[model samples]
Target chain A: MKRLMNRRPNRASKIFLGLLPFIIILLVYASASSQRLAENADDKLLPSFSSMADAINRMAFQEDKRTGQYLFWTDTWSSLKRLLTAVFFAAVIALSLGILLGVIPYLHANFSPLITVISLIPPMAILPILFIVFGLGELSKVVLIGIGITPFITRDLLARVLEIPQEQLIKAQTLGANTWLVITRIVFPQVCPRLIDALRLSLGAAWLFLIASEAIAADGGLGYRIFLVRRYLAMDVIIPYVVWVTFLAFMTDYLLRKFSKFAFPWYYQASNKA
Target chain B: MSILLEIKNVWKQYGDAVVLEQLSKCVSAGEFVTIVGASGCGKTTFLNMLLGTESYSKGKILLDGKPLPSEPSQDRGVVFQRYSAFPHLTVLRNTMLGAELSASPFLGIVFNRRKFSAIREKAEKMLESVGLSHALNSYPHELSGGMQQRLSIAQALMKQPRMLLLDEPFGALDPGTRSDMHKLILALWKETGITIFMVTHDIEEGFYLGTRLWVFDKVRFDPHNAEAYGAQITYDIDVDQSAKRRLKKELELELEKSEQAFGASE
Candidate 1:
């Protein structure tokens, strides 16, 4: 007889095991919703699935009477635009600054402590300051997300650059590479894949900062709509918006991982120990 | 042959701990110099100095009577024991890296298609010479240890360097692969007539591969403070065929006694 710890599930059983908890949670929610609805027809806490479905259709398919726009699509588009713009700028800054700090001792000595201090400072604590300086507009939201994740990503990329074996750098120099050449030829290509990985890890934090900023001050965004509906206790709309945001985050991570594997196959090969 | 390199009383120290002291030697052109020593005897430090990756505390090194550059340059090539090849590059790209860097100093890339193809062709020839033609498109991680070393050798040779520094290049290979690599390296050395400096832990390998064998040892040991003294070149023996045959037995016995002493100290 195999011990419990030694027992391994096959592929089909593993999939079944993974879905068991989600299924149980959904069942629990359905029963609770039915019980609450039985007592009061206007229970706002956990609206029945049908009401949530109607809410989704109204928000996504029907045009708003006031704005004459499909709220769901407009909010998603504006949110994604801000998030992607912030992330793009953050990635560029992280790669260039990370490589500079890692390779040059003079820069490292001067700036490493400063980066460490910046990373230690809570990004959320500076939100009000950002809003005041950049104004309560798209710029503030974008800057919030950028500031929230750039230091972390830069630190991650700097560690990756430093983790490169000293032998490789020496070999590059022996191969007639000057400092700039080494950065472009050896360090840049190697760090690009790691930069993708860092971006994937920081995406969750980026979304958090984006939502917090949008909830405070935004004309149109997913977070703005959620916060706006919260005033009326509209859990149906909020729940769907939260799930959509999660799905979008998952898709971004999945795409970035796939792109890294495709563009830098050697990185995966080396890291996988194949 | 004229002296290609001269070391004038070079000393290397890291703060209070001295590594090498008063090392002076002249290496002629086309000489195969193999260095053997006990662990922590500064042999790798000496090799790093020759490779220009480490700076000595005193004295100087001259290449063709000119002061050797403090930093590594194209005239010298080095292959470390492991991780000599870039993990991100295919074998062909790794081999072409030196040529591309030399051709485009700033960019380290050949933008012209015809020029890029010429570099690629030269890289293919270099890889073929090292018997890695089939694995040109493969990443370094895909190759076995022996094949990786061969790729490193090919990469080092791409610049047509005048001096080749190999730091225990075959140390990580199995016995069978090590022997094969020995034959390959000896053939390459014979054909290219490049000056070679190799550091190895195996005395027998030193005797077999080198025209001159250098032994580094500590003459003075401080019981209270180990860093008080540094290692020096204690023995420099010419390795002719007759001397190799005669001295091999003596060195093996000496190595055994030293190993026993080292074990007892532990």
Candidate 2:
């Protein structure tokens, strides 16, 4: 019965379910704000109008009322889009660099200490230098996150690559495996899952740095938008942006972990036994 | 009978200490020869010599009428006390590697499903011979000690080597598994018709496994002790002198005891 119930969701169902909750939430908030406006406008025309919701709804839409109330939502989307793009680019560049640095023997050995020491320093410690050199632009922001994320992923993967057993190497050797075959067929497969875990860990750091990235110099990201709203002392927009960034970060982290679980089930399953 | 593999007055040393001193032995093809002794008697050194891995300080050795080479090859398969296989590779791949190398170009070509299928089929046949057909896809770490050793045996036989050298192969296994493995090995040797040379300290293990067994004295002897004695080395001279005489006397006593014991046991 469980197997029968496990029929995969259709593409249409997946899209609908994906968009359903956000659409409903947007409608609810927009309607609540819209209704509040209608009630307040009518209250001004009449006398003896008293509802505690008027104060709360006015507070909710306070920042949105600055321009067209819908601009608030658009600004939030634009900010998320900018940061997600930064994250996407950072993740791609960082994972590639990480895999390369992690696998190369000379690079891993020679620069591992430097990489360890580099990851230890806080992102902001270098943020000022990065801002000075790259001048608080988009380049500096993305590059900063990429630089920070690369070592985190690569070092973890290098440690994992080192941990594959000597017996495994001997087994390959006695079996007549060539050096390249041993690395590709044996080492790669064994380390691939661990690399995935390291990549996921780097993704979390990338999100963190992306927010801190807007701290450098940016017209609009979740970070910049948070600071922008802070000027007006509007906690409402800031709170929502915080919530959205948290949700996005959680979703990405959760999905990567889930994908790894599905892709390399043996790795985690076997380890969890002991 | 023609000599198949011969170790002629071979000497092996581990650092300053000699393990095998001018040891000589010959094993014809299809013969089963076992070396028996107490621990550290250099029986394993003899097996290593046949496998062409251990270097001797002096003398010559031959395998199948050829001078033993510098390096051991797939022509000789060795099963050690511990199973040796890549923990990453599946058993089928492990077995296939032994057979595939040193053959025709057909052997070198992998990833061709047809060729791999054939080698895999042969590997399966070998695994079944050793009762490990169920573990074809399993890695080394997944196997039990006995199963791993069986896999090691199967792995060695995959190449159909001219000789198989086992150095206390079943020593690490439990008694029940050891007995089972011994029987299985004997059956394998009988079926395969390859020469078998093994070293074992366990008397019953040596007895049960080898068709021809050579027992070494429990203590190694040095004849030059008396010639080198000095005032400072007086105790060494006395101990070596007494030890030498005692060893000869002990051998005589042991021979008498063995004969009597054999007569009684029979």
**DockQ scores of all models, one per candidate:** 0.86, 0.13
In model 1, pairs of residues that clash are none
Candidate 2: deviation at residue B117, Å?
2.3
* DockQ result, candidate 2: 0.13
lDDT of 1 at A62: 100
Query: Model 1: per-residue lDDT, tens digit, B1-266?
Result: 99999999998999998889989999999999999887777899899888888899999999999999988888899999999999888999999999999999879999999999999999999899899999989999999999999999999999889899999999999999999999999999998999999999999899989999998877777767777778888778998999988888877776666555434433
Q: Positional deviation of A140 in candidate 1, in angstroms?
A: 1.0
Top of the candidates by lDDT: 1
Error of 2 at B59 (Å): 8.6
My TM-score estimates for the predictions, one after another, are 0.96, 0.60
Error of 2 at B115 (Å): 2.3
List chain A TM-scores, every candidate, in order: 0.97, 0.64
Each model's total of backbone clashes:
0, 1
